[model samples]
Target: MEDGLVRSISSGLSQKGVRDHNERLLLSLIQRHGALPGSDLARIANLSPPTVSAILRRLESDGLLERGDPVRGKVGKPSIPMRLAPDGVYSYGLKIGRRSAELVLIDFCGDTRHQRQLNYDIPLPDTIFDFVGAAVSEISGALSPEAVARICGFGVAAPFGLWNWPNTSDESDAAFQSWKDVDLRVRTADISGLPVTLMNDATAACQAEHMFGRGKEFRDYAYFFIGAFIGGGVVLNNSVFEGPQGNAGALGSLRTVGPNGESMQLVDMASIHQLELRLREVDLDPRQLWTDPDSWTSLSRYVDPWLGQTAQELAKAALSTCSVIDFEAILIDGAFPPAIREELVGRVRRYMATQDTRGLIPPRIEAGSIGAKARSVGAASQPVGTQFML
Candidate 1:
């Protein structure tokens, strides 16, 4: 476990100066489990107390970490906890969905300090970049010089094949087609004037959940994010395994049967778009599903059936994933209300219980805590992780 902790927090850093690696290890530990005193950090990181104290002093002096109020125990001296300074670093996260684009300015601790969004029938590259450029300027202009200096980079979360979506109209299709040739990371950097990191939208959501939600509870898990379409990511050895080509857990493409016994992907039967199609079939407005207030009480009739089918499909996908990786858990999250998410998770768990698992150990199915913001928050974490963590 000690060796794993070392590798997990700062992989491939053994050759670097011990102090540099140890500093990151301490920061990573605090980020994962919140504020900790030097003593605890030393024990967790397996560093000497003097080494931990020296690193902590340097980090605190550099503004990357801040001291908390001294906690008095019935022991020797009062231990002052340390945590990541909220203003130590900043990054912008852009989540480009089929229906909307969101730009968020987040602090070191992953809290959104400001955000801007644009909604449209379909995403156009020109409009997205325009929004991004303007939003970045507006947000940065409002910050103090010191705060602005702390801005690290920008991250974008987008689907892999942006051009094939919606399939709505010729005009929208043409607009999407432009995405096929557009270089997202380069374009975003040009607009934002900061180092840019791009990630798969669903994978970004998994990152957010892993960093800020329930991922700390397990060493490995399969995460499924139900957006307009369902997608997923894989985590192994306490790190997201993006695979060789950076597409590890493409759960949405998992083979499944359609209603009439036709072959299909999990996305075909499990995406929220299917629920939107149901609403369209009955001439009900589907816009409410994406709008604020998040409650879908009026659409419960349509949502109920969608939840049932989605849950069953997710159950099959979860088991299939575990068959390959033996994941410790399966996490489910999406662009929906908490109540609806809870219902979906419960249904998935029930469905999994009835599946055959003679050669497999069933993994726990839990709801993700990040909800709709996971993708954007996950995107923002990229630059911070690149600079400060493994």
Candidate 2:
């Protein structure tokens, strides 16, 4: 559980107006710090005990929270812990990747109750939306009527410049270019019959790490999510800070010199797509990289070099960002196995050690807890976070 100074309810609002805000705050607190008792919530929220009790009672009566077994303390009456009811609310998360797409139905507690995935040579708008419509219908139909009613909204996590990537065939390139004019939030709402929120896929992954991974330990950090293309997010004061246009941490676009003295972006240097291209050069099947039961042992000879180069690029990028914001940590995660992520983090740490840091506070380089599912889970969190949290 994360512990720190939490925002307290303002005394300026009228009691009637404050109820909704207080309710959301309590729910957000429970979501952050596991199950907490009313006394603890009151202290953290700076609310009177009676007011906390009133809000908790209302939340409990509404089926949004559930009480746990009582804990008998040293002298006072036993205190009962309260937590968000897992079945109280639900939302759908759809991740549209360059090489694949994923859909997940997550409960209020951020658990994936149902999920589906599709792999494609190139992402076509019509095919992806069709998949979204069909999957939402199929999954929602299996739930009880009450559960279906609790479905809040849909979230889509996709790349910003989806139309820019090169496709093998000109026909495929033309088809993919249609993404330039597509409005993901509006399209998804029309398909899923739910309100929609759209986010950059890597930013969504950072959100998941902030809420459910190691992000709790640092109030501010720069997050790098290595996908087909590397991208990133910024966290300030323990919150995922999506900028005004929602693309604050465009880490991939940071400039760097390539091997032959040409300028390149971090994406070209550190992305897994580079590894895929190398595997293809040697006649090894690259599809295994994205396979479910990931077996990268056979590809280690290729992966090792990629890891080294990626680590060096990431070390430079992390330092570059910190030179501006002085972040407390740098979190690295990706669409790969845990062991690979660990190795990548270790390598980044080693590389950072060799870089000159005369005046900067060196940030902690940490591995992300959520593996391949971070984007989908973070996408799911968008609706849940908006509706019932601060």
Best candidate according to lDDT: 2
Sliding window of 10 residues with minimal summed lDDT for model 2? 1-10
Clashing residue pairs in candidate 2 (N, C-alpha, C atoms within 3 angstroms): none
lDDT of 2 by residue, 24-87 (tens): 9899999989899999999998877887898899999989999998999999899999999999
Q: Rate the local accuracy (lDDT) of all candidates.
A: 0.89, 0.90
Cα deviation of 273, candidate 2, in Å: 0.7
TM-score between candidate 2 and the true structure: 0.95
- For model 1, give the 10-residue run with minimal summed lDDT: 1-10
Error of 1 at 219 (Å): 1.1
* Candidate RMSDs in order: 3.1, 3.3
What is the per-residue lDDT of model 1 for residues 56-162, given as tens digits with 9 covering 90 to 100? 99999989999998999998999999999999999999999977899999999999999898988778899889999899889989999999999999999999889
**lDDT, candidate 1, at 203:** 89
The number of clashing residue pairs in model 2 is: 0
